[model samples]
Target: MSSKSSSQFSTFKDCLARRLISTTDLDGPEGSDDPLDEFTSYLASEVWPALPDTLYTASYESLSSDTVLQEMASDPFYISLDAIPIPTSFFDTLTSYTHFEDAHDCIRFLRKVLSDYLTEATAPPPVWKQTRGEKCEICERGWVRLTYHHLIPRSVHGKVLKRKWHTESMLNSVAWLCRPCHSAVHHVASNEDLARYFYTVDLLLERDDIQAWKKYASKQK
Candidate 1:
C-alpha cells in the first residue's frame, strides 16, 4: 500500500508540472500555479477527516480516502472531483474506464486534460474574434461547407454565468472549423466542461488530440 501510494502521488505531481497543463483548467483557485498540490493536500488532510462519520446508512470513520469521495460526490459544489490519480470515469467513449487504468493511465489522463479543458496565459481579447468563414482554422482541407461553432459552448452558458466572470457574448464566442475538427472538439469534451475551461483558440490548439487531428486533417483533401 505504501509503494502504491507513493507511486500514485508522484505521478500526480509530475503531471502537475507540465507546461501545457494549467491549474485554471483543472478548476483550481484563480492565479494558483500549484493548484493540484494545494487541491490534493486539502483533500488528503482537511476534507478526508471532515466527512460525517455516518450518513443515512453508510458509516464513515475519520473520513478516509474511500469515504471522502462518496461524501464529495453527494455535495453539489464539492469544488469538483479529484483530478489526481487521473480519473478514467471523467471520459466518455466506446472504451470502458478500465481500458485507461493500466500503466498508460497517467499519460492518457494528461492527454485527456490537455484536449478537454481551457487554461489562461493572458486576458481575453478586447473584441470578439469572428469565427473564420472563408477557411477552417484547424485544417487546410477544402470543405463543402464551413460551420461556426461556439468557442465556448452555449449549452454550458447557464452554469458559466453562475460564476459571473464571463460575459454572455464570450459564451457565444465562435470559431469556424472544418467538419472533422468540429466533431473532434465535441468528442473531446462535454459542452459544459468546454465552457468552464476552454474559451480561446490558443487553448484549443494546445490540445494533443487536436494537434494530432489537425496534422491528419491537413494532409487530407
Candidate 2:
C-alpha cells in the first residue's frame, strides 16, 4: 500500500477506536444492552459510510484468504475494535473487485469473524461441576432443586465460551440457584450488565432488587 493509503487506514482505525470507547463509557452501572451488538451496528451504520469506496468492493476470496483475519478469528484476543489490523493485501484485493456482492460478502465475513472473536474474548468462565440438589446459592433455599444460573447471561457470553472454551453446559459458567432466584436475575439486568457487573454470585446478591427478591423467595416452601 502507498503511504497515503496506509495513513488513511490508520486514521480510520483511530476514529473507530474513539467511537467504540465512547460507546463503552456510556454504559452506566445499571448496564446497557449487548455491547457487541451495538459495536457491530456502529460499524454497519457509521463506519461503513465513511470508508473509501474501495472498501465497499472487497471480495469474499480476499477476506477468506486474509491470514491475519483467519488467525484472529481462530485465536481471538480482547482489544479495542479500532486496534484490529487490516492487511494491505486485503485492501488491494478489495480495490480490484467491481461487484457490490463481493464487497457485501466480505463485510458479512468480517462481521461474523469479529463478532465471534469478541464474544469469545469477553465470555465468562464456565462452571464444571454437576452439583444437583444443593442449596440455592443466591437465596440459600435448602432442598429446592437448584438450577445453574449464568452470572453473565448466556445469550451474550455463551457463544464465545462454547466456541473457544468448549463449554457445553450451564455448569460450565453458573452458580446453582433455585428457579425463582435465577429468573429474578434476568428480570432485573441486561446481558451486558450481567457480564460487566453482576457476573458473580456475590455481586448478583448485592443488587438491591436481587437482595429483595432473595428475601422474598427464601420465604417460599
Candidate 3:
C-alpha cells in the first residue's frame, strides 16, 4: 500500500473505532459503510497478522476468555451487535487465515467464545435462584428444557456450505443463555448496547459481581 493508501486505511480504522465507541446499533444506514477498502489496505500495509490457516478445531473453552472480552470492551473500538463485536478486520482475518469460508463457521466461533467463558468461570446464570426444573438460560423460564443460544445470530452464517463448530470460530464468544432471554437480549438491544452488556457480563462473571451485572441488564431492559 502506498503512503496515501495507508493513510486512508488508518482513517477508516479511526472512523470504525469511533463508530464502535459511539454508535448504538449497526443496520440500514450505519452498516453499509465501505469496509472493503479499509480491509484491503490493512492487508497491504502488513498491519494485520497472519491468521490460523487451518480449521479451528479446539473445544469452545479453549478459545473463549473473559480477559479477551474485557480487552475488547476497553479498547474503545467495539460495539456489540451480538456477543462479539463485528468488524471487517475480524472476518477478513478469518477468511485469510482459518477455514472460515461461511457464515456457519463464524456463528460457531461466536458460540465457542461465549460458552467457553461461562465454563471457565462456572458462573451461575444471572437469575440462578429463579431457575426451576432446568430453567432455560436464554429465556429465564422454568417451563422448557434449556438449549444454548448463540448471542451472534446463526442467520449470518447462511453462506457456509458445511459448517461445524470449531475452536477458532467460538473463541471469545458466549453461551448458557436460555432461549427467551437470549432472544430478548439479541433482538432488543442495539449494537452498542449489546457491546456494553457483553462487557458488563465479562466483568460481573469474572468477579462474581451479579449485582453490577443486574444493574446494567435492568437498565437495558
TM-score of each: 0.40, 0.37, 0.23
Query: In order, how many clashes per candidate?
Result: 1, 5, 21
For model 3, how does the per-residue alpha-carbon lDDT over 164-184 read when each residue is reduced to its tens digit?
332224322445554444554
Question: How much does each candidate deviate from the true structure in C-alpha RMSD?
Answer: 17.5, 15.8, 19.2
Which portions of model 3 show Cα errors greater than 4 Å?
1-133, 138-140, 155-167, 171-176, 190-221
Better of 2 and 3 by TM-score: 2
| lDDT digits (tens) for residues 1-221 of candidate 1 | 25433433443334334522332234445687876555444333322222232311221222243454344334423323243342333232102312433435534444443222111111233344553557787775666477877877777677788986465546667877877888998888788767766676677888898889889888887
- 1 or 2: which has the higher TM-score? 1
Ranking of all candidate structures by their lDDT, best first: 2, 1, 3
Candidate number that wins on lDDT, 2 or 3: 2
TM-score of candidate 1 on Cα atoms, chains taken together: 0.40
* Candidate lDDT values, in order: 0.51, 0.53, 0.39
Residue pairs in collision within model 1? 118-198
Q: What is the alpha-carbon RMSD of candidate 2 to the true structure?
A: 15.8
